[model samples]
Target: MNTIVSTYNLSKYFNGICRVNEVNLTVYEGDIYGFLGPNGAGKSTTLKMLLGLIKPTKGNMVIFSKNFNKNRQLILSQTGSLIESPSYYEHLTGLENMRILQRLRNVSNKKVQEALHIVRLEKQQNKLVKHYSLGMKQRLGIAMALINFPKLLILDEPTNGLDPNGIREIRELIKSLPQRYGITVLISTHLLSEIEQIATSVGIINDGNLLFQGSMEQLKAKNKAYISIKTQDNNLAKKILLTEGYKFKQNNDRLIFEDLTDSHIAYLNKLFIGQSIDVIRIEEHRKSLEDIFLELTGKERSL
Candidate 1:
């Protein structure tokens, strides 16, 4: 796939404090790239730099295969972003609000209508902004961003304060953008479950550092499988495992070890029975994506 955006050693410092430190981000065309992190983990700062809303203290960015600094105007003309919250006139109708942006971007009224429809706000376009629900407000923000029919869209924590139903609506709209409008999306959020559902690629950040970045399958594969066994005597099992050159963790009466194949499991069962050790039960478990996300982010609970 074509590279839509790439950053090298991107760093942002505020008042001599590093908010984003030596981070590299890669966004490909047709990808819903999920920038996952805890709150205050520099996600917003990094995105602001990408949009040129703030300058990076050091490092470089390339957008659409052009140097972003050299081609700022051209890049931004094709890029749309809703960083933080979008401002709107509460008394104005959604359609009127969209028209203001249409005039600003010099786009036709058709683009405005198309954006509102894509966000499923066509029916609510004539309603006053104050009458719109939280979900409708967010969709209006997105509609404003899409008024220019941008090729790349960046959203910073768009689902920040929505309920379950609202979240689902936004999630569906984001997931459909790539296929429907050929737009590449870079969305930052604290919710891993939402990322797991909507993102084709993932970037995990914490403490102003980028910890992991890869495809969703790669992140999911980081979860390791383990075998937990209960025996009549766990101490004996530990000793036997140690004597047999195996590593394990013990908790109370249970012994846990890394994943063993079916053949290895059979061998262990036969060996234990031959040694007159009565086995209780052995169960396999895999670490969840949430667990890995927490471990990587040091239990920062923005999610």
Candidate 2:
């Protein structure tokens, strides 16, 4: 796949305070790249620089394999974005809003219809914006961004204020875009679950630093599977294991260990049973994406 967007040592500052430190982002064609971080982790700042909404303090940005600064018009023409909350005339119908954007973008009525259809908003296109639900309004924003049929779509926290149903709707929409429209998507969010659902690639950031970037599979491969042992007599079990020279991690109520086979589990179970320790449960667990995100970003969150 071709590189659609990239940054070299991208940095941003506000009032001499660093909002985004030296960071590099690479987005490939037809990929749903999730830009994930905690709140105020420079996810939005990095995206703003990519869209030229804000100027970078330093570093270079490249999109469509062309320098952003050198080919600003050409690059922006093929890029669409909906940042934070989209502003609209509440009195106007969704179609009317799209018509206004159509005139501005110099696109035809067919394109407007197509955009609405892409966002699954055709049925509600004639409804007044004020009468629409939050999710509908958000889809409308996405439709407006799609009016020009951009090859790359940038969305900042698209599911920010959405309910579960709305988030699911948007997630399905985003997941479909790559295969449906051949458009590469760059979506920024603080939720790992959101990315796990829609993104093919990921970039994790924290405290103005880019902590990790890779395919979703690569990131998930870091999730280790371990065996957890819960017993009625955990203290006695711990002692028996320590005496037998076993390595493990202990939580409040369970004993956790890794790199063991089913045979080992059987052996341990047998041993514990023989020693009069009642084995309540023995389960294998895999760390979730959220767990890995917390580990990478540090256990203590910003807020």
Q: Distance (Å) between predicted and true CA of 95, model 2?
A: 1.9
List the global CA lDDT of all models: 0.92, 0.92
- Candidate 1 clash pair list: none
How far residue 86's Cα lies from its native spot in candidate 2, in Å, is: 1.2
lDDT of 1 by residue, 234-284 (tens): 777778888898888987788888868888788778878888899999889
Candidate 1 steric clashes: 0
Q: How far out, in Å, is residue 173 in model 2?
A: 1.3
On a 0 to 100 scale, what is the lDDT of residue 36 in model 1? 93
For model 2, the stretches where C-alpha displacement exceeds 4 angstroms are: 230-255, 271-281, 299-303
Candidate 2: residue 247 Cα off by (Å): 4.4
Clashing pairs in 2: none
